[model samples]
Target: MRILLDSFVSFFRNNYMQLAAALAYYGMFALLPFLLLTALLLGKSITSSQEALEGLHRLTYQMVPEFQAVIFNELISLSRLSDTWGWVGIVSCLSCIFPLVVTIRNVFLTVFSAQRKRPVMIEILRDFSTTIFLIVLLIFLVISQIIYDELIIRFFMAISFPLYIVDFMVNLTISTVGMTVFYYAFIPVKVGLKHICVGAVLTSVLWAVINPTLVFLLKLNPKFGIAFGSLKTVFLIFMWVYFSFCVIVFGAEFIAQWDRRKEWGILSTKHGKNGVKETSPPLERDPPSLTP
Candidate 1:
């Protein structure tokens, strides 16, 4: 109870939503460069353009279901020019990924760290490393999802379970596992897996539920983004990305609170001031004392 309360309090106090908004803004800007970089990599590895496009479509739709068509089209357009980009353009695109990664590192530091700042060079190096880590992790996630869709889903379909439900469950599980590993690896503080798993699962579930709801809302009201005029797609995408960052930051706050409780000795099971264990035994070996 105390942990939950503290988590909420710290969440609002930290202004996590505002931070998420900032992150979303940067993320929006970074998207093009990241996609271009990805396209360059894909162009080198995938000999067939059509197969690469299909893979990108699948990966994009899997990651961000909302406004995927817009993103997919953009990816297709950018991929065509990927092969033409020289070293200058390639370096330029790679440089754009750093700001977003730096922002993420700062956000995590704010939530999970209390130490003073480091040198600029050290910070830059760490940010570079984190950027590489995230990019690699994303590639791994894409591969994992592809494998699941290609093989695991086929096996499950043989059992007669609905495809939609199975996909959702698989996505939820993968998202949970991904977020858990992300928090564990990304946070500046040393934390146990048990401490981060709860927040990761909660974030994954919320994300899963909200995604379908957003799609449903859009389907129900075709003019939901009518007010945004021609920029409706961009507006919707930014809003969705913003919401995603908010959920992610909230999960970080929850994990921090869990770690905080342990630091304050509230979650300790060792002997207390009176030499009695703070936590109860697994099995009750003694009757309750009638005398309070």
Candidate 2:
């Protein structure tokens, strides 16, 4: 327990929290164009573009209920304007997603460092692929929700079971898997599977708890929406992304802390060889060893 507490302290002392805050700012900047381009692509894949549009709307509203009207209205406008945006416009928006993706890659590398930095082109390719991965993941989630509603519910009803429980479990499992994929793929370094799995599950649970509580609290101030008016959704979107970035970065930092502590023999397991993987990067200066 002491070791765990110290790990968190180290995480703060290292100023990873500040890094997370920077990520939130950049993430908010990226979200608008990224989502716009994503929705455009998703619309192309589906039978109806409107359905794709609504899926994004529904997912956003579920996460941040306070901005339901705002998201819905903005999405509607975007949908209408989608036709006006030419290939050049679409390509331009997508190019803008590169910086956010690259920033995220750098953050992950900084948090869970490798022996040395990889090539810049390789990093760029990885980050660009990550952008596509996220859009595909979102589409899969939307489709999964549709499947659960249209088909899975019927199976549970036939067995006389409360399906909402099933729905919750399924959603939770999917969220965990999605988070695990992000941590595993984005970090650009080797970490123990145990650490990655724990980080993913912790992030999912933390997000589940924080997002709803935030929604409720934000709803208490109804004046925010009226005051911001049409811009309410934009503000709320930034808030949601910002908080989420903080949670995810904290989780990564916590896992990195655990790795550091483990290497120094601070948090030893009873078993002769614990499952966590350890790395001994050759630091140019003194190592990042914690003081007694």
Candidate 3:
């Protein structure tokens, strides 16, 4: 616990500024259009069916009233806009995907320093792979949510409860996988699957708990709540990004600890052999040689 606390302190003292800037660069670009596109999509579904829209609106209101208002308004406006304009909105939404991915890659490079450990070519290749993986993951998540809304929600209302849990778990799993991939790809040390799984599980659980608690805290504090308004949206996004970095760093420590344990095991085996030699009965020295 002391070590963990020290590490956490070190993260803020060392990497907080960089993390903040990275999030600022990435969050601003990612959040607005992402939310807009999502709103547009939700709006389309809602226009097609009012009951669905109300259900979504209700969910959004519960989570983020202000941002939901913005999204709901945008969705309503987008629905009224011409088909050509709607297509444009869709394209605009899709356009942010690559930039968001690239921003993440840049942030990873800045934070992880994995590039320094591996060959430049290997690092770049790994980075590219990570980017592709994240992009695919994002798409899968969006599609999954859409499918959930369109299909699952229709048949089972109870599904919402499990769906929320699933959402948290899937996101946590992805975050862990992404971090593990980055660690192995860039870091000089090799990490095992067990280590990676440990990191992933820890990160996921941390995120699952931290996310909602942060939201609640933000909602409760007036200074943070209304003064920033949707700007808190930006801060919330930044906080999540920072938390993720913290998790990655924690995972790195876990990997480091694992490696150290292995090294200790090897060293202990050698030490035991040397200790046996020292402890064994000394061979009888021939005193006759000195007398002769």
Q: Which one wins on lDDT?
A: 1
Residue clash pairs of candidate 3: none
lDDT of 3: 0.52
The TM-score between candidate 3 and the true structure equals: 0.54
Model 2 weakest 10-residue run by lDDT: 283-292
lDDT of 1 by residue, 79-135 (tens): 666567789987776688888777776777777754427897887787787776766
**TM-scores for all candidates?**
0.84, 0.77, 0.54
After TM-score superposition, what is the CA distance of residue 93 in candidate 2 from its true location, in Å? 2.0
Candidate 2, pairs of clashing residues: none
Off by over 4 Å in 1: 43-55, 266-292
Q: Which residue ranges in model 3 land beyond 4 Å of their true spot?
A: 1-24, 30-126, 144-189, 225-233, 271-292
Each candidate: RMSD: 9.3, 6.1, 13.7
**121-166, model 2: which lDDT tens digit per residue?**
8766767788778777767766666666657778899998987788
The C-alpha local distance difference test score for the whole of candidate 2 amounts to: 0.67
Q: Candidate 3, residues 44-63: lDDT per residue as tens digits?
A: 45456655455546434433
* Candidate 1 lDDT score relative to the true structure: 0.73
